[model samples]
Target chain A: MNLTDQQRTLIEQIGVWHENNGIQPAAARVMGLMIVSDKRELTFDEITEALSISKSATSNALNLLLRTEHLEYITFPGDRKRYFKMKISNWREAFTRKIDDLTGFNVLLRQVLEVRNRNCDESDEGLQDFISFLDYLHQELPNLLAKWEEQNKKS
Target chain B: MNLTDQQRTLIEQIGVWHENNGIQPAAARVMGLMIVSDKRELTFDEITEALSISKSATSNALNLLLRTEHLEYITFPGDRKRYFKMKISNWREAFTRKIDDLTGFNVLLRQVLEVRNRNCDESDEGLQDFISFLDYLHQELPNLLAKWEEQNKKS
Candidate 1:
């Protein structure tokens, strides 16, 4: 399949950034190929040929995507080759992880604010302003997750 | 200030991961320091001394944090040295970036599913099942974000 230059650039950007952030670039490519392909699940051969990467690279990339739970592997009764398709059932986990990461940061941030406020007498209005926001965010996280889970159950 | 061994190990983990992911280890160190320090903001010398890194390393780390908008610079009128503090005014932005990142992946995943679903003939139940989740995830994202944002606003 032919991709426009803009599409190709976007794929490259996603690949490189994800790689730089400790994820594999080829996984990003496999993701890119599958997303734009006329067919959703692609075999290793198709992916390798499409991305012009080595078969080993394609193999490794696909494996990593599977390992990360972002994609799934499918085997047919009569087919020798395995097929990969995006895993959407676990999307809630992805969102949860995002919230969890922010929550993690907030835990650290709140402690800092607490100590700073306690020691400095809370005279700095800027500090108090930022502190109030952190406190509010920290307090709100659990309710937000509960609400999201409620919505998830409905749909 | 001395960090406990456990705290040091956690800091090291964060530092190494960020470094491998293209962020400088010292940048991660600065982030760690700010998170745990009694004072939220730190001067260049304080960061250097606290992290046991060089002044230049502290400067570079602080600059990286500034670029990411994770931390900001502060100036007191009488003091020539710059102070840096974590930007906690909008914790939602940090979480939102994660949502945006997922959106990027979701968009690509949806495209792949569309293409592959088309190629899977009526008899190919396995391939169709393999990609079904992508469509579901694409549909859920808008509602998820709206709920999260609504909670964020209420908080």
Candidate 2:
């Protein structure tokens, strides 16, 4: 599908945003194309042509996106081609995973704190406070996710 | 001050973690050194010696960490040297900034949804759901932070 000039600009902007977030340029461009595509779902050839990226770059980007749950594919009856769309669910999943990481990190911090506390005469107040903050986040994240799920149910 | 072999290993591990998260190795090493330092504060020369990093690399890393609020400095009344330590407050600040970024991204996504909705015949349920998720996060993040602050005050 041919992209209009305006669409091209929007894609470029999205690409910049993703690139700033540490995504490689080619993969980010593919993501940009997928997000702004009017067709919603695009085949491999469609993505490659629309983004003007090499076949290998497109393949690698698609593979990365798929592995990371940033993209998913759809197959229609009797159709050999797989159509891909952005995995919007992955947005929430990404946040959820981040919360989990924070939890894990907090746990590790606590272990470190335990060892430090055992060895030291003076308490590390800063580390203690940071742990408190992490604990608060760990406790609140689940409640927040629950509220979101409740709202989703209502909607 | 000299680092023990164990301390060196710990610092390297932290550096690796930060590098995986897209932080430069030098900055990550600085962060790791700050975290594990028994004194909790280190001068420029101390950091350079402990990490075995070059003067220029240490200088650049410290500057980046200072600018990012990841590190802060203190001075004794008679001492000319500024001693640096990790900023625990910045941990919460980082999470707060992330919430803000999510809020901003959500607003941009909503605008995209509006334009896409206007142009397309079918509603993009995935985009709508993602927006809903963002809205839920936007509403909840402040309350979570407030609760943490309240708990902090009580403690």
Candidate 3:
């Protein structure tokens, strides 16, 4: 699959952004390519040829993406080869997971507060305020996700 | 500034978490210390001594934290040394800034959609759905933050 210069630039920019966010260069490049591909899906050989990456590199990148739920593969009738595409819902799930993890950490923070209360004088109003903020977020994030789901369903 | 065994374990655990998130170990240690400190404020020497980090490492970590607004310092009347404390509000600001950046990215995605619409057959329902999801988030995230603020005010 030949890429226009503009498409190439966009792919490279996406790759750079993912790399900045700590993804490996090859996997990031694959993700970038997958996002901007006109077909919205590509075979393994096509991905390797388009990105000019080695077979092993392509396989590794694809496997990582699949393991992380960032990409999914499909097979058509009578087609032995698999075709891969971006999993857009996975992006939403990733954000949701981050919020969930923070909420889980709030439980730990509450336990820490109990310990602090037992061990120290109850004078650190700032610490108390911070805990209160975390508690507020813990209660609100689920509702926020629910609201997004409700809006998404309407749209 | 001596730490109990439990405190030491907690600090180390926090440092490991930060390291996994791509933060430097020294800076992560400083963050952990600041969070659990009974004093709520510490001088340069105090941070170094408590964390067992070298003076140069302490300075570098403190400077990074200060630059990122994760920590702030103040000087007392007639005192030459600065006392530093964790900036809990910065954590809130960081979350706010993340939502803002995502909202900003929605504009870029809209442009991408326009270009894609012109260049492609517009058969990619998945792409359109992803864009719609982003648009929903762009509209809804501010309300989530506002709701958090209202709840915080009440509590």
What is the TM-score of each predicted model, taking all chains together?
0.67, 0.89, 0.85
lDDT digits (tens) for residues A1-155 of candidate 3 = 97777677777877876776667899999988887776778999999999999999999999999998889999999999999988876766887677676665565555455544234455455556666766666666667667766876875
Q: How high is the CA lDDT of each candidate model?
A: 0.63, 0.78, 0.75
Best by DockQ: 2
Residue B6 lDDT (model 3): 68
TM-score of chain B of each: 0.67, 0.85, 0.82
User: In lDDT terms, which candidate is top?
Assistant: 2
**lDDT score of residue A128 within candidate 3:** 63
Residue B9, candidate 1: alpha-carbon lDDT: 55
Which of 2 and 3 is the better model by lDDT?
2
Cα TM-score of candidate 2: 0.89
Instruction: Itemize residue pairs with steric clashes in candidate 1.
Output: A34-B112, A35-B111, A35-B112, A38-B115, A39-B115, A39-B116, A40-B115, A40-B116
Clashes of each: 8, 0, 0
How many pairs of residues collide in model 3?
0
DockQ of each: 0.25, 0.43, 0.34
